[model samples]
Target: MKKPLSNAIKKIILDNIEFSTSHGFPNIVRSESFILKLMWILCLLLSSGYCAYCLTKSFQDYFSYETDTLLRFKRVSQIEFPTITICNKFATDLSRSNEVTELAKSGYIKLKSEFTDLTKFNEFFKRVDYYFKYNSIEYKDRFNFVGFDIDKMLLNCNFNFKECNSSNFKLFFSSTYGLCYQFNADKTNIRKISSPGKKAGLSLELFIGYPSKDYDLYKSYGAHLFIHNSSTIPSSEFEGISLSTGHETDVILSKTYFQKLPKPFSDCAQDSNSSEYIHSDLYRETIKLFGQYDQKSCINLCYHKYIFDECGCYYPDLNINKNLTRICDSDIGFECYSNHSASYRESKICIECIEKCPEECESIKYSLQISHANYPTPFYADFLMTYDALINNGSRNFISYSNVKESTLAVNIYFDDICYSIVEEKPSETIEQLVADIGGFLGLCIGVSILSVVEIFDSILRVILLFFSKRMN
Candidate 1:
């Protein structure tokens, strides 16, 4: 029985082997056509080489780094017109002789040492009353003085005053109480303290700040001053007062950002003839995204609005209405200003409002150099000889009234040394494109589709399985 079974299995296996050998491979290979075989070998080599080359090229293109042009910086010239505010530090009772005397008599000699001779100072004492009156400092009372509004001062400054010549700028002035004074000069005459030579006549030390606030903002600031001789000033006053300006020690403006890019990309970034060249549509869109409010102005206004909403009144320093309906009473105003000022600054609305302010593309920062000289006023030159004649003729006010000397400010602004570069993400080829390239290369070289390769493999596997099954039976 075992011999018969074994013989039957061997016969089935032999038949299966014969069938597979005869049918599995195409008849073309059995015919041994040399040209076809050579073609097949060449196709295999070419297809593999071409596919490898395509894949390598696709990978390089996908991973390679390239400069992005769309988001680059443009090298365009721009003119910046800065807002100017002139703040006078002539306020505080310490500036007045009476106040200094009271402090000195109280045994505060340390404070007394800081005090300068009030009689020698013309601008601080003489201008204090006028500044106070102009700023409406008396609105509160003798005891409680509301903070001075530097913004309002800038708004109300008489640009047409006897001196200013720069038509490209706007000017603002603060009252005597606008800033506190720390006397650095002793009892020395004005000429000894100022800048030397003919370039000096009246010098002004200008401190610049932005988003003008109270005393806290004025600390740790930047300052710039200018010296005016007879040539620079329109007025005849040979002596100028040294004044402190701005909300801080340093002149502050909106923060600026510079976009740096490669030279080729920057060259063609914008068209000068286009209306939106300097301020592009993209910038406008960004502005709209932030709710259409100018960043700094919006924040300041929001703070003011918050104060009004909470206290049912506006701060005295603000330009808001001072009527019974809107203005806080002196007591309430001081309390609210003192208590809620900090809270309002830290509030969410304030933070959001400031955060939404658009960034400036460019800005200028400047400092002042001051000097003094003894230049005869053009108007007073003829009057020098006539003073004796006037005295002989009995003119009492002529000697007492000294001619007012004005100062000239010269500002030179230019770009800084820092370079900025703009960058963007590089785009890459998709995986689908890479696959297609590889497939096309294989097809063109081998005359074989993906389906053809799969079919060939399937036929070989089936032949092997059939032989094995026959052997087992």
Candidate 2:
């Protein structure tokens, strides 16, 4: 009732004002009032137009907020996604240095670290489900596993990659006589599945090369692995990657991938100005498997016998003679391990297991590249190749996965979200990281405009009142 009365009063005032301008006091000719009224109307119109323009611009900006693609993770109750396996548990220490061990123990999982300087290493991965340890030599032949290129292994999808293949487990190399091996070092024992508590299991770690935060789902899942040890590692040099290990269990990092630590911690986490690749060796594995690192010294053929120094071999406990290059000559396919050095390297805690396998030597220099294109994604993943073993569903685990590619790769990711999407990167000299910046900015403007307070009508009313009062001579 009050609203109608108010409106009626306002209408009457408007009509009276209009009539006064056109004819009231015409004899006296109140031209000043007429001119002032006209001016007020024009000012109101201009204000309304300007306000509308500003509002539209602002709205376009709100929805267009720039989201920096950052790495993250999520968890669910069900197992899904294809092409994965979990072999071991890992500790997420998050530091980089000589402090490979000395991480906080979380349940059955122990932190593993390097016996020497840490570089390019990690102790857990998302590929295969990893227990807290590596498979024992006693149960080496328990599983039947195989690796293949994307072409043969990719069951579905339609991405066109340059090359894809199925792994040949029986033969180690492409050629039969090469490297004196029946199967590639990795696939030697890969097909059998075992219950978690029943047998020794696979060990995995993650080493990422690029930023993974560009994807939304990955950012939701926190690392399942984390460790904090205080004994073997001095607090100053805690060498934990995304995951770490302790003395009791293996801390493993994978060479298949890499990641950038978020902000403040990233700078403090670096051993030096440079960033090193992460690997899957727990502390103990580092001393032994670290021999496989593709260093300039290890690349050539070994003609001589086992000369630790000649081959550029170095371990924390062993003082190898650098003069004995003949000991590492690649031509003879020979390498030697001093029984004494091996003893010193093995700790008393694992003395029994260490002694059982005295001789540790292998002669091979090879690199692996994993690629596939079934569910056609962009060409961005072409160079991305790092594998992991991680928990798939609540009840299952996968031992080998080639990084978080199509988490939507025919496998159900459990969430009703975009399996994948990219955010714009801030401008840089390299255009690779500069996609869709303009689009993102526009979206932000749109969203902000919807909630804007300075509206066209409000501005127009103010402008009209200002001019009318000024002209009331």
Candidate 3:
């Protein structure tokens, strides 16, 4: 039964195939025109060959098209931080009998009596009797001073000292507060000071060096001569001194896609004749983006301006302290920093400016990291001992070195994946090639030419016009 059913289905398929070939399309198979038959066979063969060629060419073109992306690494200028200095002043002739008296004779210790006075002493030290019992009130106050000199201290260091030449210190301060001063002295001429309100908790940068070479001592004989006086004998002093020299910064470079490519080719290749394909003039574009300022300088200025506008004072970290009367106190600084941060997130002008900032021709994104480590831990201990001795003995002649244990920072820069834009050369068919292809297609399918198509269309239009005229008549 299964065999009979299979045979019946096969018989039906054969009958339909034979009927379609012999009866359904009998005009082509039974025609007597030998030229038409030959033409039909030629057309079929030519069309098949043309289709195969087109498929092969398309595959070849798809695989042969290639694009090359180049990666490049460049080292830009190094960025430096502000330098800090801790200076000490002596009030009496204790330098004559001190172990470090050479430092005083060498002008390391300057007589800065203006920093100490009866009013400041009385205000800081509630004991009024200690001021009178001392020989001279100024001498007693200067020798007994044990805090940072706020009023006379310059926030920016402008002195050109021969001893200190390098400027890479980010933090600077003295261990003892009395008669101690802090200032910035770096290659950058722009100097700034910590906010007055933030004097209590200032971070000191460790000065790395030998202790014996940098330490200085000043003995107040007046305080010792009067045994009944409350002032002590030995006191520590620091003269204009540099703590650390060099710093480290890490810079990492990476690549990103700046412009999008069109399908199968770059936009530049798509319109080679268009001006958009031309390389941008970097100088003109930079001027357009930043006006009169360069990229780095403009960014720095904008940041300073933003800080000043928001906080009512320029940042102490930057180089913009000209004609600025109102310096931001600690309270004002906190509020100003908060407002500036919020503006960065919500301000449209800032966002637009950042977006429009002109990038380099071979643009790369950079990430920076900074770190520091203190050297000669024992020197730091000696500094602390000196500070403690000064606090214990109001006028003790102790040696204090501004050259504390120095800190060294290491910067390591690494590059990641790099990407760049390139105009991909594509194989495009010329006008002649297009014409040949069209002609081949026409001949293969119907043995037709441009004239044949024109004649066929004209004949159809004439017949339609004749019919319309007959109907009108």
Candidate 4:
């Protein structure tokens, strides 16, 4: 029985162990080759994991650089748009045309740059009709002008216009708060009030930059004043006014030509720039714009949608500083002019001036022309007394850089028909090479993966052949 038990244990041990004898020399070599292949596979896995970590790090760095460059481009693009949007918002308030507003959003019509001839204006306005609807924004403009860049300023604009067609085009002037004039649907006969001076609401153009397309801030082409010099130019022509150097005159009151008295103040003197008596031709003209006694018959009939400066057509108790650059006081007579803003504190046009003629003579340069060339940024009242000459058609030509004897920063940018400015530089080298290297390295990864699979297949085939040979022996 003990012998049998020992035999059973030996059989159990034999079952657990693989007892085999090779018949030929080829079998031993083949067995050894299979063991070597298994060891190689273990090494291949370890090497592959290590290489994958290194490749991941390299790709991560390349991706980071590409992302940084794209972010910078987006920043610059944002800066280019705010200026245009701001101007569009303001113009939409005055014009009431959705067609014009849409063109503004698309960034086609830059501020200050004339939208070419009227033909262009009509075509562009027609396109403006397609996108944005005619809706009035509840709020007024809020510009952060003092110490901010274009990028920082756009954060404030919240106004959107209720764009209407030329048929519904309404001009809500301050001259008569209750009445708005409906100009012809087609923008023909632009400034055709019945009279000027005693009964006119001031009409003008404020040269603001395309809030978005203002590429050069150093040059003062951002917000200029385009006053319509009624005294210098005629009501018949606005495009014919020659461009003027905005040094002395900082603004261009577009309604100057139709101001009453049609008096030209080429060599008159006045008090400080703050006095109410220093009424611009446009101011004096306001009397004629709406002061007529026809109030009984045509109280609110003809003027359906007009924007008059004297009409009190404001946003109701809004503390918004008016576009009227010339502030007034109650001191009476041709007093001095002040540069500070009116706190609603200054006096309105004197009742006498509102009802009767001036004790002295009336100003010839109606509407107003704030030429930045002559007046600089903050224009003074005394300066308006000594006027040289005014332009009638288009913009008055200024002394271009070509006309100047010496070169200057101003000249470098403002030359002939257009302003030529130098562009800022950017990093273009390191970026290009890094991008190329990433592409090459990714391609190398595919090649390495293919080679690794081929080696694994070859090793597995060798192991199978060895196993067959041993079984046959």
Candidate 5:
């Protein structure tokens, strides 16, 4: 049996194996000197082992899912202007100042008087909830009723040298900063700016009225602003740019677009249907309330879920998206929130939301270079004051220059460059590269090509067929 097998192997190597690697194996079969045979066998084994190792490495690299970044600079005639959301640091109107003051004072008093007392704690919260309900803060029209109206905040607005007004803005309520106004948020027709200078972009004259006595809760000194995509929701409270009351803020913007590989190459969402995309109930609710899914909005939604889960009721300050009828009052729900207040303070504590909400494969972002100058010089101040008092008759629609430095904020937002960057993620080892690597390694180590592999397989198949024919006979 050993003789027949040896003969068959020798036949295959001598007659069929045509590659350079066949030299060593055939030499091992035919050599008379034992030392020469041993040397040939060792060469064959070593070369084959290295080839196997190289092929294995190539396969491992292919499966590793490594990524490479490709950065490209692109120049366009025009770029879409980012959505701008402006929120008053005060968040409430001066007219409602007394109401806000009384509510806050009453809330503090109730908490101080009844929170620690187990007997009155729950009942105190019930009354606080009643007060919130009476104020209609949790009602569907709460934004219109509670937050500062945008018409009053936007004193003058011009975009692309065209006069823009309240009609150009959409109202949205922020839980952290009461009412906010968003510009260019409509995705269907986002406004684009062609020129790249302060004179060619958006110019705004804002009147941030005096802060209320109860302004401690709002926690801002000027107008909070956000720059984001028109398709996405803005988290103004977390990452807003603050404009000082007396200064002109010029935001020089540089746009950068990002595109990432999906699925095997990366975990980023490919589209709305991707498994990595946010699919949580809170995320869906956010889409229904807001327009699209954003990581910041999803995180806020998760916090809302946490609030409901912990207090057994939704907090009145947060948007109510679920069907649950219970809203937290200052008594029980507020106390529960206060207990976990540290965790709620930072939205990143919502780990599940962070992990589940994969980033969009394609997104645009603007890097801002902000600079400030004193908004109104004495001459300009006098001019504006005269204009408001005499020409406009102190029209509430324009800035009240009674205290010009304290009441006015001028902002200019524009792109600094027409050229933008496109950052893309691509696979480091594509299938073609992997195949080439394998072939190169195989040829370098064992001097074997595709024909060599095919020849060996053909020999093996022939031997099997011959043996089966003999068995059948």
Candidate 6:
């Protein structure tokens, strides 16, 4: 039959192999003596097998997607100033806590003793629990109405020697520390500091005032301070730095930038939109409650959602719509807050929240070095007394000149260095690197390359075409 097709194809392949540029294949095809031929054949088989093993290992390493962290230094002429948030340790103003006393007087709730000043927050809660059962008071708004006033707390503010006032600050409510005042919170026109060091940054004289002895439950004295990015919602409860009265506190900060590889290289989320990681239910319900989506805010939202679903009530401190969500009271406290504490500790929803909230592809954080000194020497206290009196409007509660040291604290916040550190993640092996590694192994083991592979494919194509042509003839 016109030379069997299979034999013709095999002969063609053999002819191409004999002249091929590939190292071991041509040596095997050209050998004449039986011993020499066997040697070349063995050599070809070993080289080919080693080459295959190297390439398989190379592919496996690349697919593993290991990453390396790089530490870099950057110097900038100007850096955006961090948001500063201050919360008085004692949340409520004793003078303005008329709501509870008024409710007690209205026969809305029974009190064991006169509802004068809240000695403990539990006393306030215990008093309110009865009234809350009968009334739907907007608890969120209540904090705004009765919480500490910024005008009373901030005695003086100076930024780069420019005068700043309560008007420069925005008010936000903190569950742990009542009303908080935040500076540089407006994102439209962010403040930037071109100079480093204490004098070039922000200076403030704060009056924490006399902490009410009645409500000594928290026992945390003075004001709570936070430094963070402007876009982030301040979580003062966990991140706050304590500022004690009678001390001048200096906070020197260094900025750090983090960048991570996305997708196959890492699990970091690259999107700026918080919705990328935030649950749909949380995004829809609590987007208004928080400014940006981050691990902290996401966790808070997730916690609120779980509490609302499981207990039919939200945390007492959280802001919620009275019409839609019930605020947890003493009655709900046992079943939801206390009894479910362990359940919350072991809940799958909480674990899932952590899984959903991944590290951002790019973010910034500040590292702080804090130092303190006894503030307002006797002479300085005397001089400030006049200014303090003027701002206090001659009220009896105006920080007394004699006790100014006990009520007043000074804060200096500034960048210690103009240069910051950058921490970035890079893939250990890129695609080009992986390819080059495979090429190196191929060349060393069997003298193969891109051209060698192409030559083999070309030979197969030639065989297929010639076989078809002969059949047609």
Please name the candidate that would achieve the greatest lDDT relative to the true structure.
6
Tens-place lDDT per residue, model 6, 1-473, is 55677787888788878777677888877888889889988887898898899889889989999999999999999888899999887665556558743442344324434456757666565445433332324454666555678887888899965889999999876656667899988999999988898777999998776654443334457888999998777764358699998999999989999998988886665665555453455543444565554556656677766777777776654344334246666555434654564588687888887766565688899999999999988888876777766756644254455588887899999988787999999888899999899889988988877888888897789888977888798
For model 6, where is the 10-residue window of minimal lDDT? 129-138
- TM-score comparison, 4 vs 5, better candidate: 5
Write down the TM-score of every candidate: 0.32, 0.19, 0.27, 0.20, 0.80, 0.84
Better of 1 and 6 by TM-score: 6
Clash pairs, candidate 6, are 119-214, 119-215
Query: Model 1: how large is the Cα RMSD against the reference?
Result: 18.0
Question: By TM-score, how accurate is candidate 4?
Answer: 0.20
**Which ranking of candidates, highest lDDT first?**
6, 5, 1, 3, 4, 2
Candidate 4 lDDT (Cα, whole model)? 0.27
Residue range 1-473, candidate 3, lDDT tens digits: 55664565555444433333222222335456988767656755666677568646745645544444443333333221222233332222332344433433343223233225746653323222112112121222333332222322221222222122223232322122223322343333643322211121123222222223222222210000000001111112212222232332222323232232344443222222232333434223333433332334334445555677676775432123323244444345645754685676577756544443332222212232224443325565475446536654513232443232222112222222222223223345444655677666555554545765565455456556645655576
* Highest TM-score model number: 6
Show where candidate 5 strays beyond 4 Å. Answer: 1-13, 18-22, 95-136, 139-151, 212-219, 273-289, 317-325, 343-350, 397-402, 457-473
- lDDT winner between 3 and 5, please give it: 5
165-266, model 1: which lDDT tens digit per residue?
Answer: 223232222222343211111213221212222222211222122222221212222222222211111111112223332121222122133332323323
Per-residue error at 374 for model 3, in Å?
6.8
Q: Is candidate 5 or candidate 6 better by lDDT?
A: 6
**lDDT for each residue of candidate 5 in 1-473, tens digit (9 for 90 to 100):** 65776687667656775332535655666688999988877887898898898889888988999899999999999888889988877654545445554555565465455456667655555554444332445443544554567766666788887888999998766655667888888878988888888777888888777654542323346888898877766664367688988999999988898898888877665663333354566556656766665556666777767877777876564454423257666556666866765577665666776776666678777898999998878788777777667755675434544477787799999988878999999888999998898888777766667977787788888788767765676
User: Model 1: which ten-residue window has the lowest total lDDT?
Assistant: 229-238
Worst 10 residues of 2 by lDDT: 174-183
- Location of the lowest summed lDDT over 10 successive residues in candidate 5: 211-220
Candidate 2 lDDT over 1-473, as tens digits, reads 55664555565444434433222222123346767657655654565565556555545544344334343333323211111221111112112222221221222132232213244222122101112112111112221121122222222221111121233212221110111111113323322221211022222222211222321112222112212111111111111222211111232211111232322212212221111322222212323322322221211111111224333442211111223322222222122233323443354523432332222111111111222224313342332221122221211112223333322232111112212222222212122222243333322332213212233344446556645655573
Residue 44 accuracy (lDDT) in model 4: 48
